[model samples]
Target: MYTTLLENIPMLFNDPTRDFVAGIIDAEGNLQILKKGSIRLVVVNTNVTILSAVRRVLADIGIEIAIRPYGKPKGNERQRYRVVIYGRGNVEKVLKVIPLQHPKFFSIPLFSSPSWGRKSGNERDPRPQLLPPPPGGGHIGGTAAV
Candidate 1:
């Protein structure tokens, strides 16, 4: 079903296509801050066709990405394709077009902040501090503990 829909999507990125990509990001994407505070946007899926369509849509808007195999498939598991938008410039571009509707949204500002990823002296990290674990020590809600 999704393959057919993605295959037929217009090459140009319209509002509906933007919203659809945003939905895909909200569900399957990872807004990652690497160990050195560099930001990366990754959308993972089992279907390469869907990710190919996503890559084309993003390319139309001048954002580039690389599609690669995420992990080795286990028994009976499908191979996962990772569409990665690397570097601050690419991440910033993606954020402008696709507004993430998740708690990860809070991290968006960090990417745009002046202090983010800076190595100068005396400036505190712009990344949000992680909250302490819940009372029971289980995972927090769907959102990360922030």
Candidate 2:
């Protein structure tokens, strides 16, 4: 809602003592509030060579990503990766390294799921999932380097 000029004329002040009063009036008139929801971001087909750089960038930009390093075969050209990012605000600035047009890199919004228990939105932290059983007779998420 906007106020008319005549109705606002009483708010205009020239005396130094009225500065504080004018400020309060302006602040009260201009006050705005926001309503928001959580969002879950998932990074698919990311490049592992830039993982550390990407992590720093995300942290600096106030977004958190769960890092799950997938292994590469011997003599592979570049390390392929899958990272999950979760947040509520715009994160495209932090994801500048990703090629927005290419299919090899993309981000998706992961919605909250009641089945996941403790529903997950863009705000929830991500954990590694669907990893293959380790060789040498062990389970995943152990002390294995990617």
Candidate 3:
């Protein structure tokens, strides 16, 4: 497939790849931060080509990852694969540029703006809470507050 051509090709972890990865994450992946538990950045899909590309690209940068392929999708669903990366060290590196979409929980305070917590949020405005330094002394993101 398309990914096979990349096998022998040298893929660099440059801006191009970062943008592609970010697009993929924004559309099909997520930034997961478990409350006082664990944090991980992952992308799952039924297409293996994209995931393979991700694996190879990250590998080029010396960041290792294991691609888990589901045995079966059951019923009429298509088989899928999950590209998972854990550990704060690796997650932070990816979080730097990988734009996360839904299912992403921030470690900062619930509401940066008091008005934001009103009975009804701005239905049209879908932007998440702006990231600001926590009162406990931490960076914008919840890397330490958690």
Candidate 3 similarity to native, TM-score: 0.54
Please provide, for model 2 over 1-146, each residue's C-alpha lDDT reduced to its tens digit, 9 standing for 90 to 100. Answer: 25685554443322212233223222221111112232233433334433444454555546566667555746855554555443323333322332234221222212233222333454533421222222432211112222
**After superposition on all CA atoms, what RMSD does each candidate show versus the true structure?**
8.6, 20.7, 11.1
Best by TM-score: 1
Question: Which parts of model 3 are misplaced by more than 4 Å?
Answer: 1-16, 34-36, 99-146
Better of 1 and 3 by TM-score: 1
lDDT for model 3, on a 0 to 1 scale? Answer: 0.57
* Candidate 1: Cα lDDT at 101: 73
Clashes of 1: 0
Q: Model 1, which residues run further than 4 Å from truth?
A: 1-16, 107-146
Candidate ordering by lDDT (highest first): 1, 3, 2
| Ranking of all candidate structures by their TM-score, best first | 1, 3, 2
User: Model 2, stretches more than 4 Å misplaced?
Assistant: 1-39, 45-47, 70-79, 90-146
Query: What's the residue-level lDDT of 68 in candidate 3?
Result: 90
